[model samples]
Target: MELTVLGTGSAMPVPERVQAGYLLDDGDRSLLVDCGSGVLGRLSGTGTGYEGVSTVLLTHHHLDHVADLMPLLKARWLAGEEHLEVIGPSGTKSLVDGLLDVYEYLDGRVDLAVREVSPARSFSAGGFEVAARETRHSMPCHAYRFSPPGSDRDPTDGPLTLSGDSEAFAGLAAFADGSDVLVHDCAFPDGTDVSNHPTPTALGEVLAGVDVETLLLSHLYPHTGGREREMEESVRTAGFDGEVRVAEDGLRVDI
Candidate 1:
């Protein structure tokens, strides 16, 4: 399976990054996680384009996380794609309904289906098995653990877990335990007073000694500029000694 980082910036925009979006492709199918601002255009760069994605699994309804959702639908409609399935936390349907309500012209332009998922629910999308867990965020959010098809039967295979947007906590760490890759939201560097999102030090403390092999810090704010290495060192200083890297747009990882 290959995971592509489309956008790594947070709500605060930056030239170096966009908002939250990731594309997980397993050859036969692909799934989009979050369709934030600039994400739709980034999709085109991946050779998948908007037409290549039919399913979107959201982490939450925050503007930074769902800004380009409607644009994606419109793009797919223009591309002659007939169906789209969006899965997310409880308010997913309402979010879609509201967007369609505002953009009346886009309504009925495509076959759109919104499915609401909750924590502890296991579901299949784009030929992958996904496990969900509630996250510690200001609003209701869910972290996801994705396993490629047949990987469940392979003892050596490890799933990829995405922390979405959340604070650093033990429960979230446990949820990502044993993952081959943990793409988490480390929105700020250490010493930046923040809520709902974690700083590098805070994230490191929680992830210390966890079984995750690689931790890719994402959802970055512009403040993190030039401090990328420092952030990684902060996490290590706090006790997480695993491979740590900062996410950038277009970076692809194969697992």
Candidate 2:
């Protein structure tokens, strides 16, 4: 499976980084996760135009995570791709309905399927099995794990986990354990009072005993600026031996 980082910044804007977005392609299918601001444009630049996304997984309802939802749907509709599925946490239906209601012009332009999922929900998307769990975030948020069916491998081998936005929730560590790649929310630097998001040290502590191949810190803010090395070191100091790196827009990883 190959995962592409489409955007890495958080709610606040940063010229160097776009907002939260990720693309997971497992040869037969492609899943787009978190289509935040500027993500549609970034995906366009990657040669995978808006129509390339067959499914979209949203972690939360925050604007930073779903800003481009309408744009993407509109683009696909305009491109003659009428069928699309969007899976997300509760309120997803309401959000989409609200958007469509506000922009009545695009109401019947596309056949959009919006599925609302809870933390306990497990389903299939883009030919991959998916599981979600609740996380400690300001809003009702969920972290998702996607696995290849019938694969006798730990998450650290091929499966992937994405921690949407949490403050190092204990359940999240167990939920993400053994994943090959964990795209975690790291929004601030050390010593910052991390509320609803993880700092470098907090994330390290969360993964101290977990078995993960790589921990990709994402959803960055200006507060996390220029502390990449320090963040990695902090995770290492917490007893995790896995690779730790900050995520950048356009970064791609294959497992």
Candidate 3:
């Protein structure tokens, strides 16, 4: 699986980084994760017009992570595209229905499907086998694990776990343990005194004992400036031997 970080900034979008969003592709098909306000523009910047997104999976109903849902759908609809699939946490169907109600134009322009997901359940979106897990956070957020078909116990094609905005908690290890890559929210720098969202030091402890291949930190705040190296070193001190790195907009990774 490969991932494209569309936007890595948090609730307040920075000039260079928009809100939270990403594009996941496995050569044959592509899926979107989080559609922040500027996602479509970012997709255009990637040089691939929004023509064939296999599906969209939202972490929660938070506006920063979902602001671009209608925009993406409208753009695709106007271009004569149809059959869009969207999956999300328990309130996903109602969220979409509310949006559709507000934007009446969305009613007949596209054939959209919605699936409200729960933790520990498995589903297939496009060609990916997906699993969901609830996380400790302010909103009804979740962490998702994505796996492609025809894979072994080996991590060469192991799951990619995306930990939506969450506080550092024990529940995360099971979702991240022995995974290929962990894209977690390291919203604050170490010793930054935070809760309900993770600081690098706090979140690192949860991942310390996990058997993941790489740690790609995202959902960064502007205050996290210039502490990338320090954060990686802290996670290492927590016992994570795998590679660790900060996620920047437009960065891509494959495993």
Candidate 4:
């Protein structure tokens, strides 16, 4: 499986990064997670244009997470793609309905199916098995863990987990306990008063005992600029001794 980071910025936009978006491709199909602003444009760079992504799994309805959703639907429709499936938390249906209601012209332009999934549920998307866990965010957000077809049989096999947007907590760390890559929302650096998103130290503290192969910090804000090394060091000092990486837009990792 290959994972591509589309956008790494948070709600507050930064020129170098976009918003929240990631593409998980399992050769057969592609699954898009969180189509925030600038994400649709970033997809074009992945060789999997909007039409190539038939299913989009969202973490929440926050603007930075779902901003480009309508644009994606319309792009697919314009490209003559027939079907699109959207999966997300409880309010997913309403969110889609509301978008279509406002953009009435795009209604009925494509075969759209929206599924509302609850936390702790497991589902299949893009030929991969996905497990969802609730995140400790201001809104009802969900972190997702993705594993290729039979990886479940081998607990040590590589799987990818995304924290969506949340504070660093034991539950979230445990949920990503065995992932090969945990792309968490380390939105700020140390010494920043923040909530609902983790700082490097806070994230590393919870991840101390987790057995993830790589902790890829993502969802960065402008404040994190020029301090990437410091952030990594803070995480290391807090006790996580695994490989640490800061996400960059368009960076791709194979698992």
Native-vs-model 2 lDDT? 0.85
Per-candidate total of colliding backbone pairs: 0, 5, 0, 0
For candidate 4, lDDT tens digit of each residue in 104-200?
Answer: 9999999999998876558876666788889999999999888876455432233889999999999888888888899999999999999999999
Per-residue lDDT over 1-255 for candidate 1, one digit per residue giving the tens place of the 0 to 100 score: 999999999999898799999999988789999999999989988877788899999999999999999999999998899999999999899999999889999999988889998765588876778888899898999999888865663222347999999999999898888888999999999889999999999999999999988999999999999999999999989999789999899999998
TM-score of each: 0.97, 0.94, 0.93, 0.96
lDDT (0-100) at residue 201 of candidate 1?
93
lDDT of each model, Cα atoms only? 0.90, 0.85, 0.81, 0.90
Model 2: per-residue lDDT, tens digit, 33-110? 999999998888765667778789999999999999989988998899987888898899999999889888988888
Worst 10 residues of 2 by lDDT: 149-158
Best-to-worst TM-score order: 1, 4, 2, 3
Q: Could you give the candidate ranking by lDDT, starting with the highest?
A: 1, 4, 2, 3
Error of 1 at 52 (Å): 0.9
Which residue ranges in model 2 land beyond 4 Å of their true spot?
A: 149-158
Report the lDDT tens digits of candidate 3 across residue range 1-255.
Answer: 678899888887777778898887777777888998788888777644577674789999889898989988888888889878888998899998899999997887888989887875677766777778888788889888888654443322256888898997888777678787889998888877787788777777777777888889898888877887888788788767789998888988876
- Give the Cα error of residue 132 in candidate 4, in Å: 0.6
Clashing pairs in 4: none
